[model samples]
Structure formats: C-alpha cells, structure tokens
Target: MLERLDDIDWERLGHAYGTAEDVPEQLRALRSPDAAIREKARWQLYGNIFHQGTRYEATAYAVPFLLELLADPATAEREELVGLLAAIAVGYDEQWLPDGLPIAEHRQQAAGGAELLAAAPHPGDDDFDEDEGDAEYLASLSEDDQDRLYTHVVVAAYDAVRAGVPLLRTLLASEHDLELRVMAGYALSWFPEEAEGSLPVLAGAVTEALEVGATAADGPDHTVLAATALVAIGLLGGAPDPALLDDRRPLVRWGAAIGLARAHGPRADPAVAAELLGWAGGESPSDDRVPFLDGDLAGFAGQALAQLGAGRTVETFDALLRRIPAVSGVEALHVVGEALKLAFPGGALTGDVPFDALDERQRRLVRQLADHEQVWRIDGSYFGNFRLLIGEYGLPDKYVTLRSYAGQG
Candidate 1:
C-alpha cells in the first residue's frame, strides 16, 4: 500500500482541502503505536477525504489502503477503521435527495420561530389546485445543483468498489473478526453489481444473527453488528432467511422485515409482508426486556413497506401522523417517507406527486394546508413530498389539529 501511495500524484488529487498530499501521512499514522495519534489521524482522514459523506478523487484511492490497514494485526482500533470504510463506501442511496436542505430555517422553526404567510387556503379558495411552481415555493433545486454535487462522488465510489470487490469479498469470507466481516458486507451493498461476491457472506451473517438474537437473553453482545449485517444482506438483493423472519427476537424480526421488503418488494412472502406491516405499526415481539418499538425499527420498516406499496399506506400514514410532535418522539419524516411511498408510488415520496385527477379527500387535504398558509418548517425532499401530497392527495381537513405541529413551524 505504501509503495502504491508513492506512485500517485497526491498534489493533484482532491479531498476536502483541495489536495491529497497530507493523506499519506494520515495513512502512515494508522500504524502508529501512540493511541492518541492514531485516533487523531483516523479522524483527520475521515474529515478531509470523506467529508460530509461526499466522496472525492482521493476517497477511491484510499479504499485499498484502508483494507490493508484492516488486515494488519498491528493496527489499533481496527473496529473504527471498519466503520470508516463503510462510511466511505456508502456515498448515498438512489432515493437520496439531490439537493442540500435549508436546515437553519428548519431549526429555527423547530425552535418556535414562525414565518408569516398568506392565510391558509380553505376548501372554497379561488385556486383549488396547488400550482406546480408556486413562486412562493422552492422545489428541490433545479436538478443541476444535485447533479453537480453527486455525479463525481457516485463515479468515485463505483470505480473504487468495482476494483475492490474481490478484495473485500475475500476479507469478508476469511476474516475472523466479526466487526470487519460485518463492515465488509455493509460496504459491498453499495455496489449491487458485486452481489455475486458478497451475498454468500451476508447469508452466513444472517444465520449467525439468528443464533445471536435467539439467545439474546444472555446479553446479545453482537446484535448491532448482526443488524447491520442483515440490512447489508438485504440491500445486496439477498432474501431474509425464514429462520430470521420466524426468530422470536423483535430486533431480528424488524431487520428481517426490512430485508424482505428490499429483496421482494410487495411481492415478498405473505408472512414476511404481514410481519413488516406489524413493524410499521410499531409492534414489538417477544418480551425479553427489548425496546424495538421505542426506536427507528418502525420507521425503517414503514419506509420499506411504503416502497413496496403494501396494504397499509393509509393506516401507516395515520399512525405516522399520530406520532408527530410528540415532544419526546421518533421522527415523523420516517413515516412521511413511507406514507408518500405508498400513497403516491413513484411520485409522493420524492415530492413529485401531481395534483391532477385527485378525488375529494386528496383535494381537501391540499386545501386545508393552504388555508393555514404557514411556511413549511421541515426542509427535506421528503417534506417536499409531504407537501405535494397535501396538494395532490389532499391531507384531511383537520390534519393540523390531528397532530400537534408545534415546533414544526
């Protein structure tokens, strides 16, 4: 790895700081015996090379060295290295937003700062149809900004993974280290074309997770890694094992539901689909002092199911609506993403759900939101989708009172 580093013109390669000359030093520091120096080096490498999850020219160049570091027995904090590899490999997913959000304004709204606006639209308003490009509204920026930000990152990740797949597959198969193995699987999921090499290992991880989850009462030390393994397996087009779906552990069940949804979409096994729906509605299995419903399990499950366009679009939407503004609660956007997934398949979840051909209920939802005329506080593409749904499908007229929108601006 060091020999190869000498061949690259680091001055021309770009990370966040505009050049990659300093990256080699950070790579060497990974082998340092000084624990503090090694820690700082890893952080510096991550911040500059993989800054804000955006991959750069230097990122792909760094993958092989990262893998080499992972294989070396002399490396300290190997688990952290595995994590960095996963983060670097994972640039983003297809459903990922194309543009950055105005997070500052959203934060202000969440802090109770409201933006004055025209009176909310009522049912009998003059313009019942929510126009496509309201001058007052800003859509997910003209696709151009998104294209500029991510195209190279996607190319960089793909090029690196395409070359590194064989090495990662070997590492995943032969490594005795559990974290390294799990991370390898996670990284491979980012490159679906490499599934042939990674799926078997992911499948093995599922079996191992079932064993761990089955005996979770005895501490379940590896459940988190196991969950990551399961999710990775699912993302790589592997179906959830029956044993996993049937596992008594709620965590495994939640992960299994996500896997099945990814692998089979709505065509997933009847039992698996039912189980996923239960998860979407925030159900927990086996009472082993587990807190499945109290976390993002339901949120992820709901999103997957929404993508599948299953039976619970409205039911799931209602449940998500009920959970919003719960002072101390999970994210409402998770369910919003799910509701949009099902409610406006190929449209709603991404904020492109149209307003034409809508029945009364969808229309009413739009009208009611317009009546409030409050500036939207949420600033995600998903939130944009939710707003479109209000205009497209029309949220219920009483939507505001239905869930507290306080701190939601």
Candidate 2:
C-alpha cells in the first residue's frame, strides 16, 4: 500500500484544500502507536479529504489506502479505519442524518450520475452556465478527466469499495471489537445483496444490546450501536421486529419505526409509523433522542416525516405538520418548501394545477409552512439548509430542497 501511495500525484489532488500534498502524512498517522494521534489523523483526513461529508477530488485517491489499513490485522484502530472507509465510500452526516444515502440508492445514483458535476464555475469563467448540458465541459477540460464531475469521481471510487464487499462482510461476521462489528454490520448494509450476512450480525448486536440494557454496563453504548445496526438492517431491506417498539430503549423504538418505514416504503407498517408519529412529536419523555439527528428530536422527526411523506401516505404528512414548533434553525424554510413541493410533486412545480386542487389536509400543510417563511426570510434563519444545498450539489443537496411549489418559487 505504501509503495502504491508513493506513485500517486498527491499534489494534483484537491480536498477542502487546494492540494492534498499532506495526505500521505495523515495516512501514516493512522499507524501511530499513540491512540490520540491516530484519532487526530483520522479527523484531519476527514476535514481535508471529505470535508463536511462532501467528497472532494482527493477522496477517491485515499480510498484504497483507507481500505488497506482496514485489511491489516495489526492495525489497532480497526474500528476507525472501517468507519473511515464507509465515510469515504459514501459519506456520514454527523449533524442531521444518521448517515448518507442508503447503499443501494447511493450506488444506483452514483452509478447513474455520469455527467453530474459538484460545481462548474471555475476560478475564471466569463459566463458560467448552470444547466446540466452547458456546464459539463467546465470539468471535462481538466487533465485525464474521464470523470469531469466531482460526484462521478466519488462514484468511481465507490465502485472500488463495491468490489471489496467480501472484505467488509468478513469484518462484520468475525470482528470481536463491538464498534468494528457494529460498523461493519452497517457497512455491509450498504450493499443490499449482503443482507444474508448483515442481518444476522445486526440482529446479534440487537440481542447483545438488549441484554446489556438490563444491566447498563455490558458494553460501551450498546443501545446506540444496536439501534444503528437496526437502522442499517432496515436500510438493507429488513424490517426491525415490530416488538422493538415495546423495548425500554427509546432509540431502539425510534430506529424500529423509522427503519421499518425506510425498508418497506409505501407498504410501511402503519403500526410502526404510528409509533414514529408519536415519537416524532416526542411528547413521551422516554423518547429522549431522534433516531439519527443531533438536535431536537421532534425537529428531525419532522424532516424524516416529510421525506417519508414524499413517497408514502399522507399519514406521514400528518406527522410533519403536527409539530412545526419542534422544527427550528436553518432547516425550517427548506423543509417547509420540501413538504409543499413533495405534497404535489409535479402539479405544484409546473403550475399546471393549483394548490387548491389538493385535498384540504395536504393543502393546509402547505399553507401552514409557507406562512412561516415570512418570518424566516426576514431573520435570515431560514435557508440555512438552502444555501448548503446550492453550495453542495445544486440540483439535489437533500437538505433545503426548495423545489418550486404551488405557484410559488
């Protein structure tokens, strides 16, 4: 791995910084005897190569080295290395989401995204066009730029990881470290075909966490890890046992509810969703945290609810509007805009049909959120997620998706 690393043109690659010339030093830090230094090295790589979960030009260059470290049995920081691979392959959302796009969806999107560029306006362009066909050439002009788009580069790197599922699969089934086991279980979940191996590992983690819940000292963060395993299982197309809602752990119940919805889609278990709606409101004090988000449980719940509502039934939509007060910060305006557009995807966007054409239940939800925009726009509190969307992948940032809606822009 070191020999291969030496041949790469690190100076030509760009991370958050202009050139990732220092990346080799960071990769070597992963081998440090001191645990603190190892952690620092990991953070440095994440900050530079995959800053804020947005993959850069250097991210793909680092993938093989990251995986090489994970494959080494002597590596003390196996858990961190495994996580770093997943982080690079797709990405992680430390703030709002538990993780990035599901493995299958991400793989499909990454595979399908041939010409999508992360950005087009070069440092010196007289007139940078934003349309898909227009800006493609901006990235195409670079040296050996087969994948002129940054997203395509990330996807190309992801393909390498896809070919290495067997390695990750082994890590899931046999790794003794709880964190590595848990992370590997989730990592395998990225590839739906690996469910045969992933399900049992995740299920076993849940059982261990349940047993540990009885004593509160069985393992480090057993509940959280178990819940994540459950989520990964669901993302891989397995439903969390409905009985998980009865568990004493709130996150377990939350994961079960949300995970079930994500796995089954429109056929989501109403019983499970009812639990999610209840938890979405977070009225029950036992529900201390939302499944994946870092801030207000109810707030992120609403975001999930809106996302679910977009593809599923209005029942999820009902959960979204029930707790607007729970929604706060920069995500509100973008989220509100999402609810309206998603409520009537095409009709509202094309202005072919009016918002009034929708049933009162859905229409009311649109008006409810739109009404708040007046205040958010003035305070500049709104569009926090909006700017992030445009800043990342303009067309689809997955945060403030302010799609045109119901005669409004």
Candidate 3:
C-alpha cells in the first residue's frame, strides 16, 4: 500500500492550485490508497489549498477536514496539527461544526481538542492537567520548563482571548521568570481593553523593571515589553510622572519617551515637554558623558517636540536637526528628520535673517568663513560647498575671497 501510495501522482492533483474545479478531485484524493497518503493529501488540500479558495469552497471541503482534525487524537503531532486546525478555524470562521454532526458532541470534541492543545504537557512531563494546582505546578518548574509552559499558555491565550487573558494575567502577576513576565505583558498588549485592568499591574512590573536596572542590551524582547507596557499604560489614560522620564536607567527613559509620545494630550506639562525637547537637542545632562544616546529615545523626543510645537526657535530647531544626522542608523535618522521637518517648517539650517543684508565687512566674514585657509577650515569648506552649489554661478574674486574670509573667521 505504501509503495503504491508513493507511486501515485500526488503532485498532479489540480486542487494544488486551489481552484473550485480542483476541490472535488482533491476531496476524492483524500481517500488515497494509504493512510499516510490520505493524511498528506488532506493536510495539503485542507490546510493550504482550501484556505485560499472562496468561502463556499472552504466551507464545503476545508471545514470538514479541519473539524475532523480537531477531534482526532490519533493525529498526534499535537502542536503542528493544532496550529493548522486553528488557522483553518480562524480563516473560515468555522467556530461551530457542520450540520450532520450533533452540536453537543461537536462542541465537546472541539473544546477537548483546544483544551488539550492549550494545556499540552511539557516534553519531560508524564502528565498535564487543567485543574487548579496545574498552573502553580507549571509555574514552579525549572526556568527552561517554565518558559516552555508560558509559551504554550501564551499561544492558547492568543487563540482564545477569553480563556487566555485571565491565565496570562495570573502568569504576569506570579511568574518569577522575568522573561515570562515580559512575554505575558507583551501578549497582554494584544487584548488592550480586555487587559485594561492589568495596566497598573504592568506599570508596577515596569517600575520594578526599572528598580532592577533592565537595559536594552539585555535583549530586544525585554526592551520591547518594557516599552510596550509603558505605551499601553499611556493608552489606558494613565498619566506618567515626569520623574519616570528622567529615571537613572536608560531602558526606563526610553520607555517613558515612548509612553509620553503615545499619551498625546493638552495635559502634557510644558516643563516635561521642554525637558523632552532638551533631550532631543542633545542638551540632556546624561548625554554629555554617555558614549552614545538611545536613537529610539532621541527619535521619540523629536516626535514629542514636533507634536508639542517646541521646535519653533532657530536655536532649538537647529539643535533638533543636528541630532537627526548624528543618529546612528538610517531608520533613526529618518524618524528624527521627519519630526524636525514637521516642527521647523523651513529646514534645520534656517537662522535669523541677517541684521543688515551682507555688507562688505559681513561679506568679508562670509568669505573668510568660506575659504580653506580660515581658522575653522571645516566651516569655510561648508560655506564654500554651499556657495558653489547655491550662490550665483559667477561673482568677482574679491567677493568670493571676502565670502571665504568671512565664513572662515
């Protein structure tokens, strides 16, 4: 049977293309000569091809196979099979079984399957349970095992928000594994209003995170979670204290920036906004000795400044613009530049109009500044470059010399 099944033209089924015409042939092929062949055919037809078809085709062919998979324990690669079934269920909205199946039996079977997947035993464990003590027991496992347990719980929570949130909240509140708490906090963000009451809990977690010195260098997930929770709290109408923004820890500072940006309101204190603008301008006291600034924090500050209209002054605008080019990465630079452009209408270099239009002495200052021989050679070169590109095509040598001389001095 296996050899014959192997020989069958598994690849030739027109259903592979996911067209309606292919559905009947694919359904017929589902009863292939070998069980393995049948499973493979059903897996591809229902899981992949059927999902792409129209609602009617999906309901007719795909739903039945997924429903069957949802009930069949014999199909024991639990995780992969469960994931595929969930995808089908979500894709086609097959929350209830087809007409012929008794509703009660269908509900029981589906719930059993979901629960089994949701509460799957850790690889090293002999048994798993969904009873009261199970969570406590799972929570007490070794760090690696606890991580695995949380992963399963989080996936389950993601699938069924109703069941998932409470479990996740419990995990968020109780897990000693900072990683698990971070994961729960992140997972909680997906169901914002449902996780609304958890805001204080999450905030407390972030506050504790700060107390413990959580840093971005720790890991991306940790940084994202800490940042996300802060943003989440702000979204929930929580007011963040300004002191949170000036925390001694960089992670907390970055998170506060993200939170404050999201919390856009008239209530944002001008003092705090001024401080954020100062941070973006690279005037924050901590920046003087720090090897580098947090590009994300700097970008957030620029955004907040623009939103608050703090980039009005030439000095302030130039300072913010300077930070844009100084940012380490392209994405960071783009974000800061965008905010700068929005806040300071004309570009970063806009300075006060010359008190008196370029006079001979002022023109001389410009020339000195432009000439390479000037004390500030780079400044002269900058003006020289600008003059070559923007100044009139040709001017007298004395004018050019004066321009260079002025710029140099």
> Best candidate, lDDT-wise?
2
Segments of candidate 1 deviating more than 4 angstroms: 93-153, 174-176, 212-220, 283-295, 325-330, 340-409
In candidate 2, the residue pairs with backbone N, CA or C atoms under 3 Å apart (3 or more residues apart, or in different chains) clash, namely: none
lDDT per model vs. reference: 0.56, 0.60, 0.43
Q: Taking the candidates one at a time, how many backbone clashes does each contain? A: 12, 0, 21
Worst 10 residues of 3 by lDDT: 92-101
For candidate 2, the TM-score is 0.67
lDDT, candidate 3, 1-409, per-residue tens:
1122333333322122323344445444544556676567566655444345222212323434433432333443323333333333223211210111122332333333333334534322456332332455546556655544433433332344333456556656665555455545544544444646777777777766665555445533344445546654554445455677766655556556545654654455555565556666663322211111223455455555544444334444544554533432332333333433444344322333341444343333234224422222232232333333222222222434534434432
| Candidate 2 lDDT tens digits, 155-233 | 7666666666777767756666766766676566566666686677777777876777778764466666667777777
Order the numbered candidates by TM-score, best leading.
Answer: 2, 1, 3
TM-scores for candidates 1 onward, in order: 0.65, 0.67, 0.39
Looking at candidate 2, what is the lDDT of residue 167?
A: 79
